[model samples]
Target chain A: MDLVKVQLTNSEFLSTGIEKLDNLLEGGILKGFTTLILGSPGSSIEILSKQLAVKGKVLYVTTDETEQEVMDAITRFGWKPEHIEFTDIATKYSKSVLSREKKRVSIYEQRSKLKLKELIEIGSSGVMPAVKAQEDFLAIFSNSAKTTSPEKIILNSLDFFLSMYSQEEVLRTLHAAKVANIERAGVLFIIMTKGIHGEVFERKMEGMADCVLELNVIQKGSTFERFLAVKKMRNYAKKIGIARYAIDSDGFVLEMIERIM
Target chain B: MTNSESYVYNQNRIGLNENENAKSSCPCITGIDELDQKLGGGLPSGNTVLLVGSSGSGKTTLSMQFLTNGAKIGERGVFFTITEPLFKLTKNLEKFDFYDKKMIESGMVNLIDLRIISERLGLDAEKYTVEDASALLEILKDIADELDVKRLIIDSITALCYRLQTKEMIRDFIFKLGSSLASMNCTTILTSEVPPNEVKYSQYGIEEFIADGIIFLGDVDRKGDLIRTLQVIKMRGTNHSRTKSAMSISSKNGIELTPLLKSRV
Candidate 1:
């Protein structure tokens, strides 16, 4: 193996594995930071997220849905049992952990509103890392430069937190994401979103991320086609607005060709 | 007293990673050899393909071609036929000399039998709602993994889009599906019917307007003779054949292609 490592430049960031998208960012995205994929509903955000699952593990949190349709989507992306991971936080883990934590050490400064700390304490308290899952996640992240920091992480598709959880919970999750940035090492989050929450999430993720991209499917002429854009990339020269993406199907061979917007 | 509390989760979580070379575009599953050749090795595995044609214009047959080809090539293929019953799809395949009895038995070629599935899932009527799409998709996912389905042929997404109430809901649903399917590495083929007058613009643009590739099949009139034509409207990542080629539907083969211009016999 050549000892020379090729760091991607702003121009070379987009590798045409997709059908219509080109590299719209400065480089191969700011590695190890949070990135939001903001899109209207039915955009290819999940598709983009699934395609980007080569390095890190994806943790998808759905608040609005409990659909087999969504779960099956991950499997369709060619993730084996070893690769596909699922956690039902709202019912089993999320609500219980927080509720239990709140009941015992429930410190109500005013009970009218709470800080992000209270939110985090409740959500993460009593939530043990199902040992098997820990082992699996470690195995996923083991092959890397042995350092104090991790390589990458993902939130997968989370549009439900907007309606389901408190505003405090949402902020708490964002705070948690910042912690994940340090804990997970090289982490680039692909947060799938829809509508207004997408915008809100994007703003929060922007403060937390090193890069941000968008995937929009538009009706151009008489065909249903997709578009991709590199909205922001920190510490790199970049293009702005929407980039038209051509989605192809070579299975991990997505080609992001040009910036259209 | 209106009481509000804060929330937080300091869970150290790992998640799905971005692809190493994640720039590849996903194209539709083009089962036709010539079509694949002309359009650069079929459609990308993760993107959607739209097949638009008038009724009895080989739209279903083309979708079948996509599924059969995926099966013959050792990729798990799923054919979710919304317009026809399972038996009809099987019977129709027989006309094209395409059915592999072994594949059917071995579960390599999965015919979702959307018509029967509709009945089973209580989606029997033509006037189903968008809420039905999610449930139906769940069923599709079950078959996709159990059969290790890599190539998906959804006979139509147009019907679902049309039956839905609002554009926002449909958009959100499709975004979820299109992105999810792409992540699944699915070379999906979705067929949509076009009315004769609305040839320029499709009824629901989901299939034609949202897919990676667009192929139009229509019957053109040569004086009193009605000849069919196939045209590639758009293929984002790869080069597509611009010329409109003549096509025919036969009892034995289903869909047979012919050049538009005269080839002297």
Candidate 2:
């Protein structure tokens, strides 16, 4: 049986900025689709996401990396960082922790000198050391996503939020963002690590997304090879294939795509 | 007598034997003539006065008027704000003719935010510890020394004390701050917030005790209308009238105080 090619205009799709990937994705990611990218350590998922951001107005919600670090990585790869607006959760989280630690130290040093009444007051006031309210990063990300009408949205890694917040909270925010992106006809990319979250949760995440891609690094006697698997493409099963890829000086280079039967 | 007549009578009575008292005690004249007369001349120099009032009772306005008036007399004043943002405070001040932007720019009046100072000093605690309070006191002293400030106002000390959880910390902070600023000869006014109609002059119930003076600001219901009133409950180093006065705030007259006439209402 011969496969017939269907053409989609540029307006109907959001390009991943790689010609080969766009061809493999059938003109690129469909507009309004939420794409989930699952990768393990050494899989170069970061570079892939940054490459996806090269073409559009991007709101990059970075949880595991600071804005400066992300910009430095993007710059080092010769990508333009000017078009990206970052909601940097990593720096905020780190600063909150450091500030809490300093406050704890100061409280400890003054504890012995405080009178019993003073200690009682401190206890009653609920201003004890390290008791500051934690910031709701999910809400922050949701707010930024709602306020800005970006063409592309990228959340680099779900593990940070999953460890900090409940699954329900994370899912609610993700669903809201997905609906907003759908309304704006924009693309949303959520990055998560493979195998860390349970298979059930992983499947739930994949079910939420319109498309799912996975990057795997395999070792054969100390020589590791990287492969990008198009595991799920809702309503477009023909695009399900695997591509062996390398990160060369020019960025993500797709060596070959093996079509799935 | 009519209210206007009493206002004129009080205005005429100002500056009578007040200059002698002011010269002897080195008073920090508030420049509000009636309030200055009520304070014999003005607030005693280097004294920490607790200006206690509820919301919208003119505590902030009175403090700003005091500082701006001091600026007019060639005295530099600094307002360390903890509750309101500096921009919002200045925006509100812009409506008053006494609020001169030139005074702020020329270093005659300084408006500083305590939160910004804490951030700059790397003290990021939401609730300040005793050590943090001590460090804050030092910062205040350093600011006083650096600016050569003659008058200092900490708008709403309640907010600052809220961050300071313990009574001992608040006491130590205020006592030390008072002494340090007093040593520098900086007349300080620390605003304290309390519930309306509450007899207490401060939120913590301890600031009024430590403070050298207490100026209580309140509102009285006069025939279904609320009238702001100011009363000097305690003023050291000079004789002052303890009678409550009717106060009004306006753009033309920043703060006008008239003796509360018994027969007017």
Candidate 3:
């Protein structure tokens, strides 16, 4: 395994699997630091998170996609899903708010399908206070940390909480998450969509995140190009430019298209 | 308070004459004339009506319109809201022009939040235990009787089914609730979410059978886009139109129905 390793104070940095991407972040992302992935709908952050999951234990907290869908994607990417853990908040919200679509009714079935060590479902009982839901999510994460001590935790999106709660509530929850990340020395990936929240809300998150990775899609002629740019990384080797990437059957492949020079 | 005193209170609160209540045989006006026409004249009094639709299909709006219309005519209403909080419901209703501040102040429209009831019963506010459902029924009956409510609306009855954990429990609750509302001579509307691709009108497949009337709201696929439509699937006491009428809803006018859409050959 050509996994690059870097030493950060009080923690170990593991390779992000992509050599060019790892080189940009000075070998890899810090083990205990929180990384924010900012992008729009079409960005391939899901694939990127999956790529990162391959290195070690992953705890994927999904608020957008179903647990099965995430597992299917992992398998498609040539990784065994049994290696990862999932915390599904989206299915519960969908069951409470939306109609009982065929997919939502299958949440129980999906729960049965997961291995005992791989699933934690919050809000399964019913509609809950945003604070309570956040607490439940954090509680499971902490418990999993005790048992498995996941090396990486992925929060699929913050958009769901934005819909269910106030800016202050979500920010407070993120603050707690950041503290946990530091204490556990585990990397946390917070996925978010840009241009959805107000300027102040976005600025607050950008300031709190230890590292911010922005993904943008540019339309040129009849084609669209996707690029990942490292905007900020506190106390780490930071790259100032972008790396173009493409998705194939294997997974996300960083292309040698052009440097953001 | 005595029955006469309660009547005076409700009448003075709505600022309506006593003669309106004397015409008790007249159907409850839903505030939308097209809908009233489809229903042969709104919903039948002393009967329970079911409003079934998918989320975002305006079930809440339609129920609100019904209660507000009853309130306008000095008919007291009790709105038992389950999912949405009272403040959020009030705030959203404020966007509509027909929202009666005077009626609310005078207690012509009473909003009883049922969230606390679930909490008090030591049950999850989203899921329903049999005991909790029984408690809820008693609470509802007490409110309807105490308020002398002529109109009652339980927003999203499907939530109860979602929590109750069994088809028998849901059916039992519906039966008990329907009979209690009828005994009080209350014209009621219970809203529920339509299960996906289900042949039945409601998610549990028993609400339509138990209800006195069923107003099914849905989106119709036209050429490229979807249009809102309302159909009166069943009205037990009245002869209603079976046609699906084109419908539209806005904050200003609430729900408006056009002429029935002609079925193309």
Top-lDDT structure, candidate number: 2
The sequence of per-residue lDDT tens digits that candidate 3 reaches over residues B53-134 is 8888889888888888888888999777778877778888898887877777787887766664444334555666676677
lDDT for B253 in candidate 3 is 97
Quote the lDDT for A198 in model 1: 53
Each model's fnat?
0.00, 0.00, 0.00
Candidate 1 Cα outliers beyond 4 Å, as residue runs: A1-261, B1-31, B118-131, B251-254, B262-265
lDDT of 1 by residue, B139-166 (tens): 5554454456788777766666666667
List the per-model TM-score of the A chain: 0.56, 0.90, 0.75
* Clashing residue pairs in candidate 3 (N, C-alpha, C atoms within 3 angstroms): B128-B163
TM-score of chain B of 2: 0.91
**Candidates sorted on TM-score, descending:** 2, 3, 1
Give the runs in model 2 whose Cα sits over 4 Å from its true position: A1-96, A99-261, B1-24, B263-265
What local lDDT does model 1 show for residue B247? Answer: 84
TM-scores of the candidates in the order shown: 0.43, 0.52, 0.48
- Root mean square deviation (Cα) for candidate 1: 30.2
Candidate 2 residue B161 Cα shift, in angstroms, is: 0.5
